[model samples]
Target: MENYIVIIAIISSIILFLSAVIVFVRFYRERTQFKILLGVALIVLLAGSIINVFEHTAILQSAEEFEQILSILFLPIIIFAIYESIIGEQLRTHIKSEQMFKGIFNQTFSFVGLLNSEGRILEANSTACDFIGYDNDEYKGVFFPETRWWKHSAEEMKNLEGAIKQAGQGKTVRYETTNIDKDGKIHYVDFSLKPIHDSRDRLIYLIAEGRDITEIKSTRLELEKHKKNLEDIVEKRTLELKTANEELQLKNETLYEKNTIINEQNAKLVSTLIDLKETQTQLLQAEKMASLGVLTAGVAHEINNPLNYIVGAYEALKQKDTHSGDEEAEMLLDAIKTGVDRVAGIVKSLNQFSRDTPAENEECNIHEIIDDSLVMLHSRLNNKIEIHKNYFKDSFVTFGNVGNFHQVFLNILSNAEQAINEKGKIWIKTTKNDNYLIITITDSGKGIEKDAINKITDPFYTTKDPGEGIGLGLSIVFGIIKEHGGRLEFESEVNKGTTVTVMLPQKGMKHE
Candidate 1:
């Protein structure tokens, strides 16, 4: 029996130690004031177990009194210590909660109230009292269903009754409503309702948190006004841009009209200039004719006397004896006939020059004209210079003034001949392809420089020794060809050669 008791005591002692160890471990981890009190209890229990071990029993002769002393002394100490810490923590928590509630409640302009399930006012923050114009003590048991907040409309009373019923049934209800204050000014409030339940899961009260939305409504109106003002500004700017665009278009149209007028004037001026050049060319040709006429008249008078004497002498030989009219007399008559024919030809050429009508228009071979011009220049040409005639097999003919065309060929040929200063060749080539008659007069002469080529065809533009050329030849040719509705093309290389091509539309051809 003693051994069993001892075993039971040891087991009880181990259980107590284990309990103390668990408490100490938990206390050490938590490190709260309550944990400090629990550590003291564990120490006292540990001393009690050690004393019991020496005594071999939990009770001694004074065991009851000792237990009573420990209970009276240590139990109160442990209880008092833990109780003080719990009270302090709970008090601090309650004070902080109250302070936070007061801070939030003061800053808010909304109403807040707490009601019990009986619909009686249980608690009311300051804003609630201010909104309802009542003190906390004045509405402690006042049911909100009977209050003035619900007195305005039956619908409001029904909504309030529904919210109370839902909260009593342990449900949260949230909605918006209007309420008139003590001053009879209606206010809109958005209120959120939360149900508070007891430990038994029965709803005991409902927390109503209300927020005033008057400022939000005012802000919405201001934003609408600003939007209207911005729209007006955009409309005004759009109108301004439209006006500016119209002005720019008007200016552009005006500028285009002025430009068109100027272009028309320029065209008329160019036509007048071409006409003037043609008139000037005609006058120059007339002057050359007058000079040639004076020269031809003097030569004709001198040749006529010589021709009359030769005819007289040939007749006298014929009238003499038939025997005397031998081989010598026959040769004299032939000589006289040749002299008379030559004089007649010179007179015909002189009469052709004196005629002042416009050049005769006809279809003529360009190659034949070039050959005739070469024949006239053959005696005067430099002996060292070569001549190349690459005439087309088929004749190139155009409907134009033949005299004018001939003059164009003569002027260009004369210019090419003068350009050659040393032993060089003159190349004349005629080509007919498509609708164009291309006549190229090339000279192996000092070619035009780059800077001078642009203005080479301009009137008075010349690169020749004084008294060798008057520079009017090419200008006259340029005018004549232009009057025939043709163009003169020039291509040259410095110190190499120069080529002048006159392109005219072929006969019987018309522009499509």
Candidate 2:
């Protein structure tokens, strides 16, 4: 027994030493408190085993006793260490997983929801709650119904429900729909549905993700309206421009027609003027023939008288029984000679007056012609009509015929005098500039009417009574001025006055 005790003591000391070393190492390593506490328990069991071998005598010296002690002391400690480590690790894992889930839910805008195969709501995230206007807990077991949002028909919802159910058969569906929230606001949502399967491929849950698109839909609608409005405005402006262009084209056509009519009228007026000129020429020739007829008669009478005288004298001389000296015959021949001389002088004067010729072009002083014409018409002027002259200091000479120049002044002055009836005045002026002579005649009469002044020089165009004067005076004046390469202008106002002006190119500066 003693030998056994000593041997047990040595073995117990070795086991306790080993356990202490292990406990020390565990503390230094900063291992689990449970593991360190287990090492301490092992040390206590080894010490108890050594004491038990002595206390129980020879019977306690059996290995079974040592084994029983170790079981009693160390078994529960090992189990406790294992339980503490496993339970603590599992608790930390569960806490970390919950924190991760909260972070993911808060950060994501994606609406997440879980549903059963029958479209019943199982669980939803906060984003899903916000979209449906429900608290996350309140929607955990709600059911989805076949109903449309904002008065749309339910057929669309029914179709979406069928698609979600079909997704349960190992497929996925993505679609868009409109839904009404708890606040009665309609929202457009784009959604994707997916089915979750367990290890055995059995349908477990349906997961759906959604994105809101209401603002996008509204923007599209507004853009469409603005596009339509722009089209309408452009169409209206196009119509207006078309109408304006049509009006301008019509005005252009009317102007072209008016121009054509005016041109035709101008041609007809020119032809009529030519006919009038020919008629005036014929009338002038007729006047000349009438004068020639009278002159011819007078010449025949004068010639006959001279011949009769000479013939009678000869007959008397022939019948006489001659005396060598015939004084009576000589006296009769002298009378016959006197009659012939008289007839010849009359014939010469008639020939001079009746001669027909064109105006002879020459350098002439119009002022001198004006003076001569005034002297000729001095007796015709009435006392009531005053005459004034404004002749320039420079001489007024032009290239023209003297007879024709005289005729022009005479016609104008006579017309002026006739225009002034009672208590009126006539003004005459002559000036030279730019190698041209300007002559002006003004009459303060019951002036020419506005309608008649433009036609005042046309042949047969006169304001006088039918026979008071032939209308040839102004016409003759116009012809002479035209032949001298001059232009005539007249200005008048009714009941105020009339002015006639003539412009003639200076001598050596004449142009046709």
Candidate 3:
């Protein structure tokens, strides 16, 4: 039993010595008061264990009294080490955490304050103190609702007092209210009171916070005012529109009746105007033919007598030139004959135009009629205008009023001649399409205006200078072509030129 006790004490001494060395090493590195206290306690324990081992093994029998004294000191030193390593460290950590929480609570931006359950102001952060122009100590013990922040407004104080009472009952209260700063300026505040509870769920403190909302409140009020104004304007305009609509409906009813009566009268007037225009056109044609016939007959009679004498003289000169064998005299005689023939041709064309006989089914050679018209207008087209004639290879014969067709070609060729200002061109093309003879006359003159082309064939609608033309020329042409079961179309462009197309039914074909 003694050996077993001595061996166990020796192992215990070794463990204590290792524990003491580790404690001393930690004390040296940390240099803390607790570490040094633990090291001293461990060293005392290790010394006691060594003395016990010496006594038990008889290695130091004279130290038996010292081992008993060390054994008495062992328990107190072990207790001291446990206290310094655990309990002391926990207490220091708690103190540091409390200091950090206080720093965060005071330095926040908003108005932050703490109140006891009795509604007394326990603590106010620096922001709250500076805003109300009060020192922290001055308002520390005052009732929260009666503090400097609420001194300017009695109503705000009553409201805050109620909120505090609610918060003390463990309820959170939030509201928008006004507060006065130190400079007496009123500021809108979003205020709240929140209750803090203990671990037992008992209300302990109230946390009061406020955020400035003066600018936000002002903007909201302005928006509401503008919205009200807009509604008023819209209501007024809607009423005005409704009244105007009712008046318009009444006017429309009245106008509808008047329009019915006016339209009846207008229909009668239009028919009368059309009949009068037709009568006027017939009278004009009759008078023009009468004058032309009389003029042509008188002119032909006066010229034919002299023309017969020249023809007799030319025949006698031709016989004399043949006997003398003179080429120059023969040429002179030929020239005289040519002049006489040309004059006779002009008289024949004028006679044709002057004829009042209307033969609606006369077989007319369109090429011959066009050639006669060109002959009549030779003086006007001699030097100033170029004439291009594209005749069909086959004969283009159409059944129409022979005299009327002669007058049609004459008036068209005359118009073409007069349209040329200084130097221009006229193209006369004749072609046979299906059972119709198509005649197209194009002129490179100053083109007619777009607005005037449609009205050109209307009676008395002239673009000529006064006393130059009666404007009945094209109207008469339109009438003659219509009478022969034909169509007339005019195409013109400003500053470009004009093209007139005439379509007349051929012989043995009916009008389409």
Candidate 4:
């Protein structure tokens, strides 16, 4: 029996020592108060186990009372450690996760809300609350179908209730609906309700999402009206042509000449219709560009004020005596300064690009403009595409609107970047030929086809996928070059590469 107790005591001491080592390592890594408490409790248990082993092995015969005291003290310390490390840590993590979710939920652009299994609104994002002029507090715990968004129309309310019911049955429901906003204006919404389930597939809650499609709906309606008008005009023209054909049949002696005249008229009408369509596309592109310019200008202006503040703060921080001789702090401050400078440069480029009014003709350095445009598009290149600049020795300076030249190079460089799929190289070169300065940009990308090369500069002609581009980039580039008394040229081969040449008259030469 004495030998058996000795063996058991040795095994318990071994287990307790291993546990204590693990707890101490965890404390060393995390260095938290809870971990410290846990490590101390583990050490106490390990000490008592060691004392028991010594007493059983006849090494310390009078330590039994001390072992009993240690055993008594171990219980409360372990309880406190368990409570702090497990329960307290889990509670903190839960609160942090909730805060992160709330931030994303409120910051999203779409209308979003959470509904309980019983179809009552539990939480609504800021966008949804503001759209209907109701606070989140006002909408909480209210039946989703009876909320302010659907309260104006009985049919809508009924439809929403049906959607909620379907969602509760584990079905996703999506449809377009109309709702009245806070200002009494009607909005078209693409709405959906999706059921959320627990790990065991039990229904827990529902997610409601809505996106305003009022502009798209209005544009579609306008297009339908125009299509109807065009149909009416075609019908009228057909009837007129039929009447003329009938008259020509009756006057057979003069049939040939009348038929020729009607054919000519028909040809002219078709040509006019084609021109009208081209003009409409151009106008639409112009409107989109105008809106983009306005947005860019506003954003640049907003960012500039904050950027100045950051620069001022960084300067002040660098001069502080507390951070002197600290290499890590100095490196961090340098990084902040570099980041601020980069943002300022981007804002300057945006301001220049957004300028619509033509400035007086100035001496623009060809290389500088190209460099600025590259900075603007650095994000797209992402270091995947290599840029090789082979500028002319003597800086090719020309007289033109600096902003227009910036736009020209920006559009060209952007096209070159988009042409490459994964990895490629872009080479920009400049040289002078007689009274003209020539700039060429070459890209090692999937080149344009022979058929598309000619039409690439035409308005609304694009080879890119839908929604990726509007195909007006080259058209705008062409217009800018022509305005500055320059000509644009393109050379390409399938799967090989493309070279774009831009030739502008040198300074002191007549632009006309």
Candidate number of the best TM-score? 3
Q: Hey, what RMSD does candidate 4 come out at?
A: 28.5
* Steric collisions counted per model: 0, 0, 0, 0
Q: Report the error of model 1 at residue 232, Å.
A: 98
- Residue by residue across 1-512, what tens digits does model 3's lDDT show? 98888888878878878887887787788876676766777677778778777877778888878867766776676677688778878888998998887888778878899998888989888888888898648988799989889988899999998998888888999999988899999999999999999999988899999988899999999999999999999999999999999999999999998999999898897787577567754754574665474677789778889999999998887776364767787778889999999999998887766656655657788998898888878889999999999999997898776678877887787777777788999999999888689999999887789999899988767988898787777887887788778989999887678899999988888564
lDDT of each: 0.73, 0.73, 0.83, 0.86
Compared to the true structure, candidate 2 yields what TM-score?
A: 0.37
RMSD of each: 28.5, 33.0, 19.2, 28.5
Residue 306 shift from truth in candidate 2, angstroms: 98
Worst 10 residues of 1 by lDDT: 351-360
Superposed Cα deviation of residue 262, candidate 3 (Å): 6.1
Error of 3 at 329 (Å): 73
lDDT of 1 by residue, 280-319 (tens): 7665566456446467557766777887787787677667
Q: How close is every model to the real structure, measured as TM-score?
A: 0.37, 0.37, 0.48, 0.45
Candidate 3 residue pairs in clash (backbone atoms < 3 Å):
none
Q: What's the lDDT of the predicted structure labeled candidate 2?
A: 0.73
Worst 10 residues of 4 by lDDT: 280-289
Model 2 root-mean-square deviation: 33.0
What lDDT is reached at residue 136 by model 2?
A: 33
Worst 10 residues of 3 by lDDT: 282-291
